[model samples]
Target: MVTVKLLKPYYIKTDEQTVRVVLAYQYFTLLINQRVFQFIPIEEKEIRVSRENGKIENIHDRFAFQNGKTVIYMSLVELISAPNFLNHLHSIAQPYIQSEETKSVTLKEETEQIIKVLEERNLKRMIDQALDERNKVLFDQLVKLL
Candidate 1:
């Protein structure tokens, strides 16, 4: 089983058609078995969402992210079926979805606060697991993200 968590939303960019949200820092993490894969986009971490309902679209079904030398390709279709993903996405996108601005600067502080809180929580959880398993390298790396 895989568990998915969406950690942050950078900001929302509303256009005539596409609404882009540049998820900042380590945007999300995918946990498979006891191992965690934290996704930090070096280039593009694109998620196409429906402007109508805010649910993630299937058009761009696959996304790739790198950690050290390992590159992982994840499917949005799989994520959409993941437990609690829709709810998390809805919560992150709700305010921006309702906003009328092309790009909302108003949520900067709020977004940062959300990111910090989530990042710390995520790191702490992973850190504890690492510590319990005596995985020093993974613990050290996760701590650096803090």
Candidate 2:
């Protein structure tokens, strides 16, 4: 399940009139750690038009991170429908899409490496917690002795 955290909502004045702009940041940290996809961190910008009177205008921008750098991997302007938006996403992610090339030693192959790193980090956290518990127990024993 993807969880979307809404940062804020505001209005932007455009050429015609004021349009509602919803700003949000979505991170699939858990899913990425689970090795679901290629796990490229993305910066997504979405603009939703008013349905009551104004016509819907689709504007989206996505930035993909690679080698500690960000690149504008995808962009769509004046997208009229949701399906179009999905199509745009597919086009942007086409390079990493499942194929023989992806199976080979490519950037897609690095996905497993990233997942392993995430798993190791999680293990470290678990070890830290165990150490903290053991320290607490030792402290309690010392207090009893006193």
Q: Which candidate number has the best TM-score?
A: 1
What tens digits encode model 1's per-residue C-alpha lDDT throughout 14-57?
76445565655577776756467677665456665666456565
Candidate 2: tens digits of C-alpha lDDT, residues 27-141 = 2111222222212434644444532233334456542323234232433342223234333333333332344554466675698899888877766665566567887765555
TM-score against truth, every candidate: 0.53, 0.23
List runs of model 2 lying over 4 Å from the truth. Answer: 1-19, 27-48, 58-68, 78-146
What CA root-mean-square deviation does each model show from the true structure? 24.8, 21.8
State the local distance difference test value for candidate 2. Answer: 0.40
Give the range where candidate 1 is weakest over 10 consecutive residues by summed lDDT: 96-105
How does model 1 fare in lDDT? Answer: 0.68
